[model samples]
Target: MDNTLSRREFLRRAGMLAASGAAAPMAFNLSLMSEAAAATAPSDYKALVCVFFSGGNDHQNTMVPYDLKNYQAYATIRQSIATPRDKLLPLPGLLADGRQMALAPQLAGLASLFGQGRLAVVANMGPLVQPTTKAQYLSRSVALPPKLFSHNDQQSFWMSSMAEGASSGWGGRIGDLFLAGNSNAALSCISVGGIGLYLSGKQASSFTVGVTGNPQLLWGSTNLFSPSYINELKVLMSTNKTNYLENEYVKVTQRGLNTSVQLDAALKAAPALSTSFPAGNSLADSLKMVAKLISTRAQLGNNRQVFMVQLGGFDMHDSLLAKHPPQLKMVNDALMAFDSAMIELGLQDQVTTFTGSEFGRTLSSNGDGSDHGWGSHHFVMGGAVAGGKIYGRVPEPIIGGADDVGQGRYIPDLSVEQLAWPLAKWFGVPDSDRYLVLPTLARFDADALQIMR
Candidate 1:
């Protein structure tokens, strides 16, 4: 008798598996099972924190070209949305090319970090199927990332290197590679941000946490219900499970409870941070929790960790001038506090933090705001980063310049995978298995940006 199931049968079973709180395996060219079989334990500890700027961000305003020539051109095209060149905070260390670069007025903390040589920028980076040029983009001669400038699709692609609806993001895949090394494998990938594809992998799963660092459960109470009710609830969920599905549900609930208990114990045992995180700032709250986890990594018994935190309201389509500044200020304050906390813990070199967005907005303004565009500038911050430098090409701000596809929406000179390569390598994924974490790694020059030490 044949053992193979028909396609419809497979789908039916897969749906059942999903409904039972177990993730159905994602199909890929190389099985993640093979990756698990070859997995090696990491000897040392490190964490990668992804700070995602939700909605399309205007990279043009984030890092401005400050020389007389470039500044004029940038200001000319940007119009009402331009940050005055005088108001920009000048970075003291090294300037890109022959021109000085400055951060927006709100990003004072980041500018100071740049001067201290702890932060760097990767310019004109975006998702691409292969090397693409402005002409190629216009003519459709080269393959581009699907659904360009789309909010959800670009966000998914930026995180997973796949289009929307993709399972298994790169962060979780990295968690998969080092699952054997972790004493508590389930804690390898964590998310303080929303449920993004960035934190799910074929074999690795994300454990969600809130901003305050306290562990939570799906079936347990927080403020409204008493902690004493947890035992009663756990017993109720686990009791009298006869079938496999029921048993699996009980197991998932138990796993969550265990993680909650373990994390709560570790957090309570750890010393509080001397560094201060701003109150009521969502990003700061998330990063503060991440710092706490990093400090308590030993108690959690994980050698490698991946974390995600996010900030939103970057979709400055209609009110660029009025809306963008406060967001930048929040980012600046949160990033500074997180960096200080890492330094205080003597883990500055052990942890790397980076910023990302779905896509960049157009350089040319449409009266009130800017439109979504292709390439964007991003920041890499940590002691190990080759800071005070700009990696990849900075797009010329001229409306119809060499790099612009149209409307000053610059074409990317570097792919998103190229930016992730060096960071993943620094996080302890070896060259051979880099492709496991980043599926698009094969198409780009690995570690070309060379941002890490």
Candidate 2:
């Protein structure tokens, strides 16, 4: 019999066991675990919600250059796809150079949030091991992220620092640190976007739930044919087995049953939200579920939590002008509703929600639409955010200019680590442990963008 366990298998089993309310027996523990125990306790209630736009979003259209000179350049390059200056919703602040930016007309809700100082834009963010300039990129002097411009690879890179097939993500790693602090650590990281690498930690994994439905036990858990059948199933699950694979499967099944019951009860007991989310908006539905979970935090005994929700159809390879508006509107309305819901729960100051994507679309259009590009504009919203401003270096939109590598694919000035650091620090991760959460963070300046107050 092969008794040796692979590293992957070991971590998976350890994570499962941790989620199943057993943490003491793990044979290996990373230094992060030790530091996590000593980390400061979070505030009364705090949560981070990550809204991911699947497929690359055309951020250039989302955050349009409304100033005359910049708009002319953008319009000239974009041609038919450029959002008309009159249709753009102007933002409150100006760029350092006194150029004005505007949100897409569909993003009126987000523009309102900006006006209220509850939202701040983070310009040109992407996955990077370290700062790289266009010169370095053109000269091939620095190591770039693996598999640039590919959808699957970039998505994985954005979520988990590693390219596709990475096991642990930064979010999951963050959860690993604070899981011990929660009464039910399994609930510390929840996903309405399905099981993603973002929520798979070495010692923790996300508890996935349907956005609009209650969690249910497996079919056998309830008596269908006869009561004896249910009893038999229970006995079989509880019985100690000789085969390792069978034993592990049974353990996982049992833990899942236990978790489902707890979550179902807690969700049922949660108070109904007063804020009205737009009906038929999938993103809003996901955020609605997150709000319910947050509302029931005390019931679930969680002080710190991370959530991920998804919105698709951002690819926009063709018919971008025809299709992108509704997508933008859906996201804007959903975000606005979520902010209001947080206020209703009186957690506006405690919860921060941010946007992420695989990558951004190109600046110059490909006749009808744009191709995949790097470094997109994203926004952070919450009462705690240092709002009404833009963080990071906003690049010039000129195609083949200093920022663009080619065809208007801008090099990211800000790494993904920088975007995630402040949220981790605000959630109680100590400065000493930042490197543990973000492996490549030390490569960049330790100064985090002051988005969170």
Best by lDDT: 2
The TM-scores of all predictions, comma-separated, are: 0.89, 0.89
- The regions of model 1 sitting more than 4 angstroms off are 1-37, 93-97, 214-227
Model 1, 1-453: lDDT tens digits are: 221233335446536333423122211111222235246777778999999999978898999988889899899888888999889987664444677778899998887777778899898998888888777877899788889989999898888888898977888887787777887766778888645478787777776666665432233334311245546656776686776544554555556555666776788799999999998889999899899988888888888999999898998888898999988989999999999999999989989999888889899999999998989999999999888888887877788888887788888888888988888888887888888888777877875798988
| Model 2's TM-score against the true structure | 0.89
For candidate 2, the C-alpha RMSD (Å) to the true structure equals 5.0
Residue 198 alpha-carbon offset, candidate 1, angstroms: 0.5
Q: What's the lDDT for candidate 2?
A: 0.81
**CA lDDT of each candidate?**
0.79, 0.81
RMSD of each: 5.0, 5.0
